[model samples]
Target: MDPLGALQEPLFTVLETPVSWTEVLGFGSGALCVWLVARQHLANWAVGIANNLLFILLFTDAGLYADAGLQIVFIALACFGWWSWTHGGGPADRLPVRRTARHEWAWLLAAGAAGCAGLTLLLDRATDSTVPQWDALTTVLSLMATYGQCRKLVESWWIWIAADLVYIPLYAYKELYLTSLLYVGFLALCAAGLRSWRRDLVARIAVTA
Candidate 1:
């Protein structure tokens, strides 16, 4: 059986749009992963890994090569995040939400700009991608956000919000409506995550003081 065959099976329909089982599954796992992360639960990484795998299949079928490729990097980052959250903590042995330093923000912004430019050029030249700029921007922002998340930075949620806003329209234009809706949900969840993490950061700082 083909690896992508399962992704082709229709789970439902939305306004004449066929929603695949893979997209439904991806939607569930992706929402769960973000929710868990908002609650500061370690299992978000594992759920995120499953979500990444599902999206790899979904995006590949949609001809979204950049997004499909991004899932691979997300998988690797998820693994590192899983381990880091468990061991790369303070004396409490659990990661705590913290503010991103100014210097780190500068580095992250520069890297995001550079990555988006390079990936957009590559996709434009190497693939038949029509929305290369949007794809590359979302992909690069996601990478920076994931890295920030691994460090338990409160700013990660902001980056996620930015990526989700771009992803929603991009997925819809690609005819992946369900995935687009998923990003809509992601946008709301990112706000919740930002609020939750900010609260945690404030509490941690108060304790330190």
Candidate 2:
């Protein structure tokens, strides 16, 4: 009876697939990270770093190569975001939340489309990823969302909500049940985050005016 072996054993069955400890840990941490993000807490970045590391292993083992690679980028971005939240505001105490402008939305949409096309081609040709189109869509939009979050832009949540919608079904099809469930949670949090940031933006505008 090995102790580590017990941890690796299936905690339960989901649609005949074994749910293991690894996914459980990843799911928990991911949930916490999203909650923190929704609340506009600076600690989200640190928790996100942990979540990214866990998901890197989880995604790699699950054969989601692009997702695994995305975790690496997430790790780096988490570090940058941590620093940005702490110090990027300069003379201000913290970065202020702002709404995304119309022009910015146009550019972001264009970039997301281009990224999806390029990543879909790369993944389809270069890797054995089964859900290449959806994977690429989520991955590229996630990048945009992350950049928006680091800048404290309110529209990041909107982008995250879109990505999570696609990710939920994609992960489920891959039989990564816990990760799929986590994305469902993410969708709700993204909605909450949108409202939270909108209120914050309103307050900021009121103060400035």
Candidate 3:
């Protein structure tokens, strides 16, 4: 097996060294879903849709509204992404990694900012959650990151990597240290994605050159 895969093998536990069976199962499902996503299999999104449901409940119980809500959106986008990658981009077209277009980047930033404001106001008013604003900011950015991933944008990994780095501490603060480690794994996966996708992009350029 590849070194990256080997490294991930040891991290398949849940909730500290003690390892809860429930967390292990959830983490395993989530990991399998991500592996499929990395392989560009359309079925990944289906697995992800299921994983999102599980995570929605997990995050909701943890008081992570932004994450819970984002999971719902992920379900919608995962379906859209699965369809688009298969049919929208041309019946036989391959999903290729590409740099983010200027307009697309602008849209992501604007959407993130708008999402922060909107979520902050709504969460603040709707509940007594302490970190509603932070929750919204992270959620919006994470939404953009996931959307970027669905499109196979090279920069999506960067956005996700950044977001996950921030999320590590945030999850820890919420006493979900196990989930924090999961974000760490996500950060590593994002870096791996950057490398793998860059290789793909360079190969394409080399062939065209």
Candidate 4:
């Protein structure tokens, strides 16, 4: 009868796995958040923030400190993305999807490399994370994808796809099977997002042409 313990208690059994409230809510909110993002809806940020909070609790309980910490970062990024979509649109005040620039790609790649290296070292030294390298890799990819999404860069979907691929196996190894299944859904949503965003970008280009 502790409150936190009650919250973490099993909601039901999924394939003999005790599914908790955090995982179930995280799964639902995560799916909705990504679906909204794929549809270019502003509410995705709000839903995504809620999902991050739940994952923070879920990851911490699972001893995935790196992912737990990443959820905090995700909250901040979601706020910035919210403001960006509302205010960063030039003149029209409506952000439109665009392609990543050549120079921007170089910087993003460099950031990914440095972030992965630094986070891997920190997680390996500071925490008992068994999958530090893979965790760090996915963390960096998620960061890149979030930044790209905030900027409305169509390439964000590619980065998301890469992260989802890593996340599926990583979560499965961590015994977070529900979260693993969620990432499988994310992979499909990301493909749809890529196709949709690319269509928007092409339409914009044609309008200017």
Per-model TM-score, in order, reads: 0.96, 0.91, 0.84, 0.96
Q: For candidate 4, give the lDDT.
A: 0.92
Off by over 4 Å in 2: 1-9
**Clash total of candidate 3:** 0
Off-target runs (Cα >4 Å) in candidate 1 are: 1-3
Off by over 4 Å in 3: 1-23, 88-91
User: What is candidate 1's lDDT per residue for 1-209, written digit by digit as tens?
Assistant: 77578677887898788999899999999999999999989999999999999998888888788989999999999999998899975757888788889999999889888999999999999999889999899899999999999999998998899889899989999888988999999999999999999998888889999
Residues 147-198, candidate 4, lDDT per residue (tens digit)?
A: 9999899999999999999999899888888999999999999999999999
lDDT of 2 by residue, 69-162 (tens): 9989998888888888888664376888887889888998899889889999999999888888887888998999998998888989988998
Could you give candidate 3's per-residue lDDT for residues 1-209 as a string of tens digits? 76423333444433454333334445666667666666666788877887787677667767888788888999999888887677645326766777899999998898888888999999999976778877887888789988998788989888887788778888777766676777777777677768888898898879879
True lDDT of residue 30, candidate 3? 69
Model 4 regions lying over 4 Å from their true place:
1-3
Candidate 4 residue pairs in clash (backbone atoms < 3 Å):
none
Q: Which pairs clash in model 2?
A: none
Clashes of 1: 0
Q: Which 10 residues in a row give candidate 3 its minimum summed lDDT?
A: 4-13
User: How high is the lDDT of residue 192 in model 2?
Assistant: 89
lDDT of each: 0.91, 0.86, 0.75, 0.92
lDDT of 3: 0.75
